[model samples]
Target: MIQLGTRWLVGDEPPSRLPQPVIDAIYEVEGELAEQGVDASEWSWTLTWLEGKPVVELDDETTVEYDPETDSAIVTAPEG
Candidate 1:
């Protein structure tokens, strides 16, 4: 079984497998972080599967939620 709370460093790979959409979501976050003057490899990602959907949360609390309806990844910025 996949662990409910898997943590991986920003530059490291998750030991547990992740869905393609989740990976795409991370990439989206990468670009956003870059624009914010943050290195993509300076933080970490935590994987959480909710209702069969993967939700990857970044160290700064940014999220990449998978939307099955659109078959796409949605990146949410961390709330101040």
Candidate 2:
């Protein structure tokens, strides 16, 4: 299980075998982060869920929620 903020994100399967839609979401988020100058080497990444939706959470409190139906990722930041 991975913890993000006050929520715990868990999965019952291996990451490598994640569904293609999920993989696509991960790639999309990674691309967005890269464009924003966030280096993959500089932060850790994990596949988890937020509000029942798959998301890629970054170490800096950045989250990219993936919507499989729309094949899109919604990026969010920590709220102060």
Q: Report the number of the highest-TM-score candidate.
A: 1
Local accuracy of candidate 2 as per-residue lDDT tens digits, 1-80? 54333222222222654456655555665667668876555456566655666666766677667676776656676787
Instruction: Look at candidate 1 and tell me the lDDT of residue 56.
Output: 86
lDDT for each residue of candidate 1 in 1-80, tens digit (9 for 90 to 100): 55476878775765446667778667666776678888667678888888877888888888888788888888888789
Off by over 4 Å in 1: 1-3, 14-16, 39-42
RMSD of 2: 6.8
- Against the reference, the lDDT scores of all candidates come to 0.76, 0.58
lDDT of 1: 0.76
State how far residue 50 of model 2 sits from its true place (Å): 8.6
Largest lDDT belongs to which candidate? 1
For model 2, the stretches where C-alpha displacement exceeds 4 angstroms are: 1-14, 48-55, 64-80
Q: Which ten residues in a row have the lowest lDDT in candidate 1?
A: 10-19
Q: After superposition, how far is residue 75 of candidate 2 from its true place, in Å?
A: 5.3
Query: How many clashing pairs per prediction, in order?
Result: 0, 0
